[model samples]
Target: MLFIKRFLDQVDEKPHLSAVADQLREITYEQLCSRARRAARVIAKISSEVMIGVAVNKSADYVVSVLAVHLLGRTVVPLDSHCPISRLKQMITSVDLSLCLVSRCQEDKLTDMLQASIRLIYIEDAIGEEDANDNAESTRSVEEEAPAYVVFTSGTTGKPKPVLMPYRALNTLIDGMAKATEPRGTTLLYASQGFDVSFQEIYATLCYGDRLLIVTDAQKKDLYALTEQLSKERVTRLFLPTSMLIPFVTFSLYEGVTLFDLSEVIVAGEQLKVTPIVRRWFKSHSRCRLINHYGPSETHVVMTCQLDNEPDDWPDLPPIGQLIAGSDAWLLDERLQPVATGCSGQLYISGRSLALGYYGMPELTSKSFITHPLTQERMYNTGDICVLNERAQYEYKGRHDRQYKVRGYRVELREVEVAVLASGLVDDCLVVASQLGLTTSLILYFTAPERGQDFSLSLHSHLAATLPEYMLPSFYRGIADIPLNQNGKIDTAKLPQVGGVRPRLSSNYVEPQGQLETLVCELAAECFGLDRIGANDNFMEAGANSFTLISMLAELRHVLGHSFRQTDLFEFPTPRLLCGNVQRSKEAPESKNSIASDTKRKLRSAAIHNTHGRMRGRHA
Candidate 1:
């Protein structure tokens, strides 16, 4: 509430300042506050101090709706407009949400999908229907102890538990960010609406009285679109998932640009690793300033490790450096006793940045959230394995639990294992997890009665229904038996590695012949961090998302000299199919050339110019 009050103060003082802008339009602080006031009139009619779902995408409407909820002293539950209908229904049911601010375009879908009892207020129409002068403010005081927001997890562990983040904690994060970065110019609101990072984006920008550039849903993952928007918006502050930072920078470099000339790139949402390429890139681009962070959703950010100064002596995974001010952390062993410096132990964070525990999970909360021995401040066991080096800097080891991050989403190995077992296909399964460079992947190793290409295909199809793409295993390998040590426990060391299986993605095997075909195969292997991937392997089946494709496409453009659209990969995922398409696309113009070479070259130049013009127009 304090943060909202501060943001509102900015809205009142700097009425003409740029508040938020998207592809279609921009809004001043006055317009944004006015719209939020109008929205508050409608929202207050529902119920005060109740949870309200804002089922919208990355837009000004979402910003307005969240503010409206805060203005009414209600909690905002962000339901991504593009989320699966099943996930949406589950969240709505779990939270007992009866009212949702739905975009006009998404009304029919919500009406059809949701129960008749639940009401969907069309935010687009509601924004303008009520007068800004209406006195519909709730009587809730700013001193009220209520949650600011509840961000839902990816449900990879089991079900998505809502992480209750209080207003004071939220306020503290933004206040800290303002001091940490002294943010100026526009900040990009680029993450998913439901993500906790988006919380940082919205509040950090507005609370600090800075501008926010909202990227459209379509432009979110498309590197070409994002780069253009970044350059056009002149974004000076940006935060990206570790998964996306490298690839985006790679794409920007290929286009002869850094992500931004004067931007502070804070890479979080997952473990930040400094590869040789990332190290070299940061050093070469002197203007690039980066703040690498590591923490769980429960703890917003525990440390700020400077990434721009990645020394040649940097390890594969650098230490998640010094703690944030006012944060007291402990490296504890299993007994919760302090471990010696330079010894690996689970990290327990006691700080203002800790969340107010998981919503509706008191037992679980009591277990993880404990009182500090030295300081009685409520502390959270991060379940993250870390170590305090002799230099007094904390370094990340890995997660103590089986949990891992997939594209910035928290995923538990047990969750995937449970889903795999529920299929009634495999009795015993061991998910072999690995990370290559910055990409994290899983390989399902199971013991089946009969093993062949059909086994993997069936399991893949079964998983597609229950698990999200990021949670699915990239490779399916059948083992003769579950490896066990003398203690009768599964020995990961004894299990067969992925490449040794000598299995094709599908029954139909197609070997690479040409240079382009071979290049596609290599890209697939590298992108997915696979030791062996056939030309017939589907990228999606191999856990390759758009982020992977962005990096892959950048390389292809450099090597093949053919600029291809991102959509081309979805249809032709296999290397054979993609290679064919690229070849045909390349030869199409030359094969059917009715115009001269000079005219074609001129047309190409004009086309590029027009594209840039359109990109500029979008941000206008």
Candidate 2:
């Protein structure tokens, strides 16, 4: 059955059941249906476009907008409101969007950023209209091959590519997920609307008569608040990116918070590592199970590994497990021939779970999606290297392009990351190869329990014991947190640059001399949770990222009664240099107007700081 019909059946069966909710409000099944119908009527009257864009924040209105588009048999093109205006504009043009639905809070801003030719409809206005008789049943017979939505990739290589998913593909995913696990009772919708995973979170829950809990932007950033909501709302099923699961579990365990209602925890979007903390978390919460899911945006979710065994028996690196129903997997060599059973090869996928090709880019689509030589089936090149184990399960080797050569030796970045994680010296780590003019340098970026603690010497000894010289990283940088993009995967672009003078790991601490230097050092120490910060220590080397630096600057502005821009950090990274600049600024004369202007600037800076805090809550 179509997901829309299934949802309508659910509404008819349980009219008063809680359907969807956010921080502000909660709505029942009947109310959600009514709102979707009203919004659909408004769209029918104003626009005839088939592709409608949803550019609202994470709220009940956002869900309503998506359902409204589906009611009219139109394709949804989700646009992230937090993305830059230029990027949004480019996406709008790329999909040839003529109409977009937005919330009243963002209408003015989007109107200015979007093209004048595009029509914007306010969701509040639609929902506020007089209650009308439902008339969308006729449109419920949407063709299975019709486009359901268009989701864009992160575009690490070049411009973001749009992948068009059909209704058949979505239905297959919903069925597979239902069979994988019986979803029930208040599942959290944590993924961004633009990401394909959001579809599973939204449709899979609603179609199964489960309540959907929408997380607010503020709650997402505050771990304490997020855990409180999870326990208070009795969320039964939760999905988190692999990068966030460790920290979330560790924090809850340390805080003595009990999520008695949570029964299942699903993680995806990266490799899953079974660290000691994870094993301990499962040991404590015996009722809750950990499910590791693996798939790309093109195929919503095709494989899963459910860890229900004893915590002590789990492997450090779990296999991605077998393919779900409605999907077929093929391990092929570079020449497109089937490889040996145990040998590693590029993974190819075909069957009902496959998406319709990339929208309007036939050349790129042909390059990625091709026909099998023997079976003559249309398959998508997953670009992931995999090997079949003795248990008939596929183990993920790194990506095809993730392998790089240094000093005439090939190195798999994932292997180095595994070694770093196994050392247990750091909480999280990411290893990447950096290219400079003609030399390629291996850099390791990591986060630890003590952000300011230097682990260079210990890590060097650990890697030297297990890995070869070429595989060892030349530079190591500690950060407050590993940066994650909107989709919850590691954001390599946000990693701090390693171009400046490398600080000696074993250097003697230099004490602050004057009051200005002392004040700077004290604030730095407090921000990073350290005993004291040396005047000559580099902020970046001392575990400072762009987000933390902005916050530190805002606090400094409030205390010193002087304004400092983010660029100033690049110019004077050390506390001694920063104090020197502050001393010079104090010596200059100030007028009454200048003081008033400074006060206004401080207020503005405070607002920006709050915004940054919200942005920091997003998982990479």
The collision pairs in model 1 are: none
* Cα lDDT for residue 129, candidate 2: 56
lDDT at 295, model 2:
74
The lowest-lDDT stretch of 10 consecutive residues in candidate 1 is 611-620
- Give one digit per residue, the lDDT tens place, for model 1 in 1-620: 37787787787688898899986788988788888888887677665537888887678888998888887767888887555565567677767778888776665775577536477787887788546374344324654347777787644445667887776667667666764546458889977888788888888888867899998767776777888888887888888988887887667765666654555788876777766566666666667676777677887777877753444656667668788765778988787778876789988998777788877778878988998666676889888888888767788878877778877877778777877787888868888677752477678888776654347778888877666566778777777788899999878888776632334555355677865576667656555655545678777666565567778877565445466677878888888888888767756766432334676667655644543453344334
Off by over 4 Å in 1: 107-111, 115-117, 129-140, 143-145, 154-157, 179-183, 308-316, 447-453, 499-503, 590-620
How accurate locally is residue 277 in candidate 1, as Cα lDDT from 0 to 100? 62
True lDDT of residue 1, candidate 1: 30
So what's the TM-score on candidate 1? 0.88
Error of 1 at 233 (Å): 1.5
| Deviating ranges (above 4 Å) for candidate 2 | 115-117, 135-138, 179-184, 402-620
